[model samples]
Target chain A: MMCENQPGALIKMDLGSLTQTAHDPIHLLPCEIQYDGHAAVDKYFTPTICQGVSAKEVSFRGRPLKGQEIKIPAGYIGLVVEENHRPCSEEEGRTVCMKSTFLSFTQWNLETLPSADDCAMMSLMWPKISEAIHRPVDSEE
Target chain B: MELEKFERNNWGSCRLSSLVPPLCRNQHCCLGIDEAGRGPVLGPMVYGICFCPLSNKQDLEELKVADSKTLSEAERERLFEKLDSLKEYLGWALQILSPNVISTSMQQRVKYNLNALSHDTAIALIQYALDSGVQLREVFVDTVGPAEKYQEKLKQRFPELEITVKPKADSLFPIVSAASICAKVARDRAVKSWKFLEDLGDVNLDYGSGYPNDPKTKEWLARNLDPVFGYPQFVRFSWSTAQTIVDSRAVPVRWDDCDGDEKSSSKGSQSMLSFFARKKDDTKHQPHRFFQERKLETVKDL
Candidate 1:
């Protein structure tokens, strides 16, 4: 795909196929609702309108995102964390999902996601699958 | 707990214990014990045992057991596999002591020295085989340590079985040689597939034989010396070679010998005015052989 700067205010872009198979089934789209320069973010997911478009050669405007948010989110944090070490709003202060985090999936969530009682009887046998990859070499101490 | 269903706990760490297969009844049974990786600076030192009915002596002899050092690795492995398949007639066991355990046992902090550790492991394997109901009348061991003391220890453990803890017994006894091959094969596989948990970055790890004299092992140690953490755990840190490399690479930590005891006694308070005053205990001595009062004997132009 190629990105070309066109005359006036339009940018011409080409989208092509990315891979042979194993395409991502999920895509997130951004929507903006504005009052002057202030924009209200509506917590809503959009249904796919263009189903057959190949998601290759997407033109990124301005700078690409620094993918920090994926690793550590900026959402609600636990109270157990120390104040100095806890993830804080150092940049723009409205607490957005701790950049990439914020989703509630705690040890407490284990009670709901797949509770111990809800798991199959074979759940305890998981270790049989996790054999040691490398046994230590002999040491003549 | 999720761990309750598992038959054993240490499916994860190195196996330094015995695993004796059940022996078939009938045919006078005897056993041979030998070790591999004893002097190597890498991998677990393995003690292997081949116990079979007296009838299978010819079968073990047919395997053409010799000092594992003489056999090629592929040859040793082939023989090991054949011995493994004959479990119905022959029962074998191994005590795989991981490098960590070996290092731990030999390190400065632990005083259970290598000979004792090796002896204990060998004895444990024999005991395990005996407990597994294998009728073992005689046992032959290939040992580097003093055989008399080793034989005594084994005899004390199993008073009925005839025990011969002879150096180079692997050369004399075909069964012991077979055990030696088993040990050597296990050691080879272990060293070949040793995994480092840490991301070693670009360090090449094709160390040859894991022996101290191997230049490749030395090179790998030199290449992988982490400035702060030293070598990876696969290295026997207690081995002098590894210890020397790690110590040389490390920041020399010369800790002063601690002389103070735990007691903290308070001294009696002294008068603050004592600081300015001369002590009564001060004694003065006359200067001997001094050129006092500026008196000088001048010798002119002699």
Candidate 2:
């Protein structure tokens, strides 16, 4: 299940909507949510979503290209996935700006996240609400 | 939308403002565009555009829409009221770029300069008017950059229209003046009415014209300057005026920018990118749906 509490935050999510049904109960997974508040300002599309915008004007420096030439600037490999996966439709090719909808219930929900490099995750969790934030995106949307 | 913390205050949120003038049928209309608060580093910079029938140019002229920079605040407000009363003859729109958006764009390593942002916004408005069935023939624009280059760029974007990008087009052309008034008035109102979501009611403060050199604005910034978190949302942290103040107060941290440049050749330390890249490769079994390309959009709330 996914929890989409904020709009316009740059987030990594499954390409299509992450809901099995419209009424899927979306409660946080019962573990400390790893990534929170990773909003739009947190990152930007490295090459930018403007690449290959106009399908009609698809061309190399001078010569024409076969299929639309999508140049994905080395995607943002940050806390949130801000990369445009290459060779996708115009709409889907760009990194989707969203609040990460799901907790990595498998990897992050483990006993603890690695703190070897003094990661930002160290002080992120407020000991108080550490109990209730892992719910799924609203309606599992 | 940059400052997630100030979600309550518009100081962080950017918005587009539009007032669709009465649609002029068949008769070709001339459009005017101009920007306000381009220099000031405190508040939102607004790009305004207005269009009307060639015949109505006389009416707009009579309204005495002049260069907003030269007009008094009260005078600008009054003229806008008159422009409003003649709504059938005026069609206007505005895009307000907030300080946060301005700062973030400038602050980013791959900078999106203000000129480029303004150009795109103006193009969007012109495109909007054309799409909405308005017949435009000429476009008069006031520019801060080289007029010829600006004109060329706008011409490329909109070839059919007669585009004039000149310095002080607002003063030379009545319609451009109208656009200037619209943009300036909108910004004045936006700044005056801007609300802060964070409750700092105890500290009574007033931000004068957001120009960096303004005594009142400087005083306000000086009073509210924070050592660590930076100033409130209205300040453009990217601007030197704000940057100098913030940097002056910050306790600098030293770093070797080239640390772990060649991780493979180095004995132990790993580059930030290489370290993270190795981790991503470990998750090979993620479901297909989870690997789909994600789409992100910056949205504005009313």
Candidate 3:
């Protein structure tokens, strides 16, 4: 399926020096939250992590979440983007700014560990695979 | 009745106490320990200790505080109130363990069982009373597990005090009967005033005794189960009754340690060779160990 915005929103991401500095680690949670606006994640979701038998255990809202920190592959950079405001009209293309960067993020599972079956961990492998697949092939071969 | 502690964080256990009887503190006192709601799949388990001057044992008997299990809810309430009226001669303390705490502790990686939790709560209540200057010379406890072992454990903890543990101590000892009443009444109140942290609308308070075998409780557990979240914090998630409902009704959650070793045990040195031989034709497209472990694949479209 293809989705096209007629006057597509243009996200002008500035991966400039200001945004290159590392920020706090990110976390990918299993559950979906209804609201999408800014949240006081630092204040409310301060995770007290303990090492479990096979994973890192954390309690979020009285529920157990287990996972581990996954680092970005070498020679790769992760950028965090944020929009200043919604565009007034469709004609006014959206501009999202790069807020910060991160080298690693914690991937959480609901009462489980981040495993090969998790889509987030699976998706992270793209850069390494892409780099190998797109490499120059010898004409002699 | 003094529930100000719950106001801070409702999910954790809290202690409540009656005034330390001024006269009882100076005299040789007998303390009794008992617990309520241990069989329930819902609500908190309360450990109560009731103590009074050894001379006031007759007063407790006169008040007709029998085994709480033998009394109706109404009779228990009346007797509890009567006991409260004689607060000048008696004192009581309760350690209320929240369902959340019970569930979390039992389900920990190290696995703290219910019996250990109960023993600890009972011990804590006794220590708290002693620390508060109760002249406790003897303690009577309704046994959990083997009577001898529990008695031995308590004797080790408080060698000075005479500790007696028996299965039906509540029926034989008036002070223990009084402690049972305190535990039962406090458990009832805790269940009655429980507020759901989840946004469950108009929850039915009548969960019917909360015992696993109660039909009304079984139905309540079935009806109240949320497909994704399982049950509210009121339910003991570690209870097999709650776990069965979750297994059948809730979404599947796979923990890493559960089956990790079992899957790898069948494989040996030839596993890598077998894998290479099986997918030789598609080796170029095959994902690396990192991707395979997380079950990831390259996207063909956005």
Best candidate (score: DockQ): 3
Query: What does candidate 3's lDDT look like per residue over B1-302, in tens digits?
Result: 66557534446789999999998779999999999999999998999999999999998898888999999999999988888778788899999998878887887667888999999999999999999999999999999999999999999999999999999999999999999999999898888878765556588877898999999999998887655556767888999999998877766655555556667776644556686576656646666676677666553322
lDDT of 3 at B186: 87
Give the Cα lDDT of each candidate. Answer: 0.56, 0.60, 0.80
Ranking by DockQ: 3, 2, 1
What TM-score is obtained for chain B in each of the predicted models? 0.77, 0.78, 0.88
Name the Cα RMSD for model 2.
18.2
CAPRI tier of model 2: incorrect
Model 1 scores a TM of 0.55
Off by over 4 Å in 1: A1-141, B1-23, B253-302
TM per model?
A: 0.55, 0.57, 0.68
| Local accuracy of candidate 1 as per-residue lDDT tens digits, B43-143 | 76778888887777888787787989898988887887787777677767767776655664554222668888888888888887767778889899987
Q: For candidate 2, give the lDDT of residue B8.
A: 39
In model 3, what is the error at residue A108, expressed in angstroms? Answer: 6.3
Query: How badly does each model clash, as a count of residue pairs?
Result: 14, 15, 4
Candidate order (TM-score):
3, 2, 1
Weakest lDDT window of 10 consecutive positions for candidate 1 chain B? B1-10
lDDT of model 1 at position A64 = 10
Ranking by lDDT: 3, 2, 1
Local error of candidate 1 at residue A85 (angstroms): 23
